[model samples]
Target: MNKELEHRFVTELENNQNIVHKICTLYTNDKSSHNDLFQEITIQLWKAYPKFRGDAKFSTWMYRVALNTAITLYRKSKKRIQTQDYDSVIYKIKTDDYDDTEEQQLKLMYDAVKQLGDIDKALVFLYLEDKNYSEISETLGITEVNARVKMNRVKNKLRTILNP
Candidate 1:
């Protein structure tokens, strides 16, 4: 990549690094796995950076690439050991002035979300990030209607998990 493009990619990636963090958090069960996933996602993004067209927003394109890396490539790799015990993942909530009740509730929600299938977890992550159906569809490469349907199902699933 040329200096200009490399600079652009770096600047944009710095601004949007949270997107990668959120994906890593949602997909990985522990801190080490999260770090590994983040590194893999970054490498994948860099490798594909040259092919990025400006037709879509950089963040949107980043979401597509990041989600694809997390969902498809990362999972298939032999290095990842999938874990089902969501409670093993630690959520670092700064406890100074934090309400215990609220923190526990948030932990419960995260635990519930962690139990979802990979695709459902991605949908929930996008929804929680306030992405509209269109953006979710574009990121996941699913139809808008399918995104809505899937989101509704995920929401219902979460409700059941929380309430049951």
Candidate 2:
């Protein structure tokens, strides 16, 4: 890659690493699997970077790549197991806008969201990341009205998980 393209890719990756991490967390519970997923997402993003036109926001495009990569990327191992236990892995981190309770709540929310089916988890992830209905629809290849309906259902599902 040329220097300019390399720099742009690095800058974009730095800006969007959290989204990759969020996807990684949604896909697996083990630290090794998380790291593997993160690397896979990063590799997929880099591969897809060359095709990114200026039609959408960089973050929006990045979200699509990450989601597609998460959904379609192949893993060699078949023995990996899914676990729903986030209680032992939960932690609170400081954010500019969140208090301790909010931080904890966010972590717990991710835990609950992680328990959702793959597609629904992707819906909730995009929603939490502040993607509008149109962006979510484009990313998931669904209609805008379907996006709205699915998002509403996912929200209610999350509310039940968070409040119960």
Candidate 3:
């Protein structure tokens, strides 16, 4: 890549590293695995950056690549994620926005989300991130209706997990 393209890619990746870390956290059980997955996603992003067009927002384009990288590696793994350090993975939730009860509920919800299948977990994560159905569809390569329907099913699944 040229200097300008390299510079741009680094800048964008730096700005969006949190997105990659979040995906890594979702997919991996331990800090070691999380770091590995993050590096893999970054490498994949850098390799594919040349083909990225200006058609969509950089972050929007990133979701597709990052999610795919996580899912693909997840499928290739032999063992399930054993355990996640909830404190380590969950950086923080402010007291102003959420009380103790709400924070506990959020942690429970995250645990439930972790039980979902890989694709379902990705779907739920994107939905929780406030992505619209259109963006979710585009990111996951499904139709808008499919994204909405899957989201409804995911919500029901989470409810069952949390309430039972």
Candidate 4:
């Protein structure tokens, strides 16, 4: 890639690296698997970079590529298991910028989100990141109405976990 395009790609990745990590974590249970998924998604994004047009937001295009990569990539393990404690997870996710309570809530929420099916997890991840239904639909190749309905169900499931 040329210097300008390389710089643009780096800028985009830096801006949205969290989204990539979030998707990888949502889809993979273990750290090794998460890393693998992250690498795979990065490869897909880098490969798809040449085709990205400037019409949509860079993040929007990223979501499309990342979601597509997540859905289609296959790993040998499919079982969902919870091995990390919420407190530990919270501590790990915490940054200097994040409040303690927000970190705790995010960790708790991530634990509950792990129980959701892959597609539902995708919806919740997108929703939490403030992506609109239209954007979620486009990213996941689902209808907007379906995105809304699935998100409502995911929310209810989350509420049950939090309240239980």
Q: How much lDDT does each candidate structure score? A: 0.86, 0.80, 0.87, 0.81
- Given candidate 4, what's the lDDT at residue 133? 88
lDDT score, candidate 1, position 9: 89
Candidate 4 on 1-164: residue-level lDDT in tens? 89898888888998899999988877766677678889988899888998998778888788878877876763334443446535435535546876689768887888898888778878888898998988888878899999999988888998998899
* Residue 110 in candidate 4, Cα distance off native in Å: 0.6
Each prediction's TM-score versus the true structure:
0.84, 0.77, 0.84, 0.75
Models sorted by lDDT, best on top: 3, 1, 4, 2
Worst 10 residues of 2 by lDDT: 73-82
Instruction: List the candidate 2 regions with Cα displacement exceeding 4 Å.
Output: 73-79, 83-104, 162-164
Give the root-mean-square deviation of each candidate in angstroms: 3.6, 4.7, 4.1, 4.6
26, model 1: CA deviation in Å? 0.3
| Candidate 4, lDDT over the whole model | 0.81
Candidates ranked, most accurate by TM-score first = 1, 3, 2, 4
**What is the lDDT, from 0 to 100, of the residue 132 in candidate 1?**
92
Give one digit per residue, the lDDT tens place, for model 2 in 85-161.
56556885657975578768777887898767667888988987888888899888899999999888888888898
Clashing pairs for model 1 are: none
Give Cα distance to truth, residue 26, candidate 4, Å.
1.7
lDDT of 3 by residue, 1-164 (tens): 69999999999999988889888878877778889999999999999999998799898889889999998998887465456566676676666855589768777877898789988998988887889999889888899999899989998998899888
| lDDT (tens digit, per residue) of candidate 1 on 39-141 | 9989999999999988888988998888888888555754666565565555766768866898688778888998898889889988889999998898888
